[model samples]
Target: MSKLALDAAVFSDAAVAPDTRLVNDAIVKALRALGERWAAPLPEIRAARLSGTGTFPLPPESPRARVETIPGPRGPVPVRILMPDGAPKGVYLHIHGGGWTVGSARENEGLTSRIAANCGLAVVSVDYALAPEEPYPAGPDDCEAAALWLVNEGPARFGTQRFAIGGESGGATLAAATLRRLRDRHGLSPFAAAVLTSGCFDLRLTPSVRNWGELPLVLNTEDIARFVGNYLRLEGRADDPDVSPLLASLKGMPRALFTVGTRDPLLDDTLFMANAWLAAGNATELDVYAGGCHVFIGFPGTITDQALKRIDAFLTGF
Candidate 1:
């Protein structure tokens, strides 16, 4: 990538922290290479979600980490429940990201454990159904089931009333959708807070999505279209607020923390959502990390450290 071209690339966001530039630039290369070797989309999605689970150095099994399947509306929903050694604060519901087509609760053990340990919050990471096979309501449906189960069972199982839902990328979108489901249909808002990281809240491609089309950063907008296609059927209009929570009324929504990189394709999604969140008279913190890109929090480095601090601070209010 030439200096001028690289500067124009999604990875070129000047806002990225200096310490993060080195790693982010390399990951951009890796993602581009990954995108080049396209095969069957389904297998790729499955493999993408599963690839890092085995090798990522995990903390020695925190006595807190355990796996269980909770019953969903259709059937059982598998989940990985992580407990803090001190816990007793509240429940932090987690959904993993894989563009709604891939990702599992088990794959999120590292982050879940870290959250549970650092925040002193019991973390129940939901293993919601994925897309292309499950599609549309399936992912949100399972997530809803998990949220409902947590609201009812959390006090008894985890011993707290405060509940927060969060996820990264596609998982973050489901988390938002889950909140909508809980609020609109059930007339409940037991959730105290939400932490969303680099999510595409507008499947409709209303504004920023199109402006940043096909920029090869960590995520390709073209690939985003594929993920969206697989996740929603034709009848599932892209504009449905259920699919794109940013389009929904933010009034009465829980206070939220949205983190995204200035260069992330979804950058405007977070910014727009945060502004709307405040417009709806809700508390929101929009943390735009410098020189960061989508899913930047997952990588190790000073920037990740800074982002975690922000997340921890957000949780403090809850």
Candidate 2:
């Protein structure tokens, strides 16, 4: 059976192994815990700022991470580089998600470092500018600058021109926008693959975001609005492809693996983007995990384990 057909069995969790499940009871409890933490009502736009989630404890300081300040269109952008070993097979550019507000490159150390260590890829994670202060174009501009630097200097520095880009939540929006900028303006096709996870593709609040308000999500409709509002305060339009990648042309973009959960508020974003990619005659794979809230791949457990394994497999092919 094709992978799509296999999904039926995987989701059912009957004829498949333990690591893969569409819905697990543990995920439900995890979601509920998160809901309780965010029990306070949404803050006003002016008063809104990302809640204190503390930096993820730094991973083992091995393989040594290099923090560098690169000149971006908006002056400077910080990037974290993690290389597992010498002579990496490829370089992976990872963009982090925190509603374009409260996340840093080290937030993805657990994921990016593993990818670098096991997959023989150098992982470059961008610390893009946050919104409400920098907003819209600043985030995309920084990401674009990072991509441009990688394409120009990566081969000489990392010894590999083969690269892929991916992001989650707000970062995914920036990643997709960066890819479009690379393709449309620079005539670049350096990405061998793309991975978008639980991304908000539409800034106008797509139907999924509109309907998932009462649902217990790490990101719900109200939070979505606040993030988008903060981002657009400067100049991004809701329908502009850069702000809403779903509205962008997917033509000539690299093959992508799109992941989202059934209960995720951004479910429709992934579905819509995946369909558009396939419709544009590009390779696409869509995986929908049942009962999962927004961006569960980073969450520790069986589901994250399987998702990372899946990510590793996808990179092997690229």
Candidate 3:
């Protein structure tokens, strides 16, 4: 059964790893140090200079479809739309993960293109404004606007009735928040499904947050706290369901495919959200990679090959 498969996936990493506890401790220490350095608020001038770094390499000869700029409250937001060479099955709006503070559509172009090519779907990768500059609601708002534009325009532009939303890390958070906003504000559910990978669903740290501190993964509690601090101006708002979709009521949302690595600090957040969705009578599928780290699914041809395969399979079904 699928449940048994999921359990095996969750535990497989533990079965192979030796001295996981010791490895976790060293990971925590290294992450703490990185957190301290990244905590320094860079000037807008300096941040812009470093913006292009850490981006994923683009695929060679991947044809660029059309680049569109939509007006955001602050300014025009650039979105890279990638289309398959042939007719597409559906469309997907992708948000790239970077803890809500770093990373951009450019950095994730390769992954987005790969998804489009493999899934036979048109992908619109949005470059939303980052935090410490735009802050809460701004980033999420930009995403909502982009999604709205797509729903309103995609029918004529792409000739597709079915649509989906997806993202990893902070991008995943935006996707979930955008879904909630669309339901509440527009009274429309345009997406056929959604994919959330290693999402930080709960802004208010939970028990799982503490456990992530003990994992040897790329993301740590300290980095997350710093991300939260940059994204949320008011501390009390951290628990608001709009900011933290895990706390939101999961009624009338799209069917979801949740992915996470066992070593990812956000593993529990993904599990909690998926369980909540299922309990709410919504269809939910989960793929947990044992010993996989945060955003590992983005690393194509790497340890995350199986995870990406599962995603392709899930999206194809939709």
Error of 3 at 74 (Å): 3.2
lDDT of 1 by residue, 177-223 (tens): 88989989999999989999998899876355667676566676776
Runs in model 2 lying further than 4 Å from the true structure: 1-63
TM-score per prediction, in order, is 0.89, 0.85, 0.86
Worst lDDT 10-window in candidate 2: 46-55
lDDT of each: 0.78, 0.78, 0.77
Error of 3 at 306 (Å): 0.8
TM-score ranking, best first: 1, 3, 2
Worst 10 residues of 1 by lDDT: 1-10
Ten contiguous residues minimizing lDDT sum, candidate 3: 52-61
Whole-model lDDT, candidate 2? 0.78
lDDT of 2 by residue, 76-182 (tens): 78999998776889999999998886677876677788888888888899999887788888888999999999998999989888899998888888888999999
Q: How would you encode candidate 3's per-residue C-alpha lDDT over 1-318 as one tens digit per residue?
A: 123136564466454244443444565566555544454455542354345322223344347556789877778888989997678789999998887787767667767777888999998989898787778878998999999888888988889878999999999999999999999989989998998889989988766677566333567777788788889964438779999998898899888899886777787788888888787777788877666667876543344667778788877787
Candidate 1 has a TM-score of: 0.89
lDDT of 2 at 258: 85
**Candidate 1 local accuracy as lDDT?**
0.78
What local lDDT score does residue 104 receive in model 2, on the 0 to 100 scale? Answer: 74
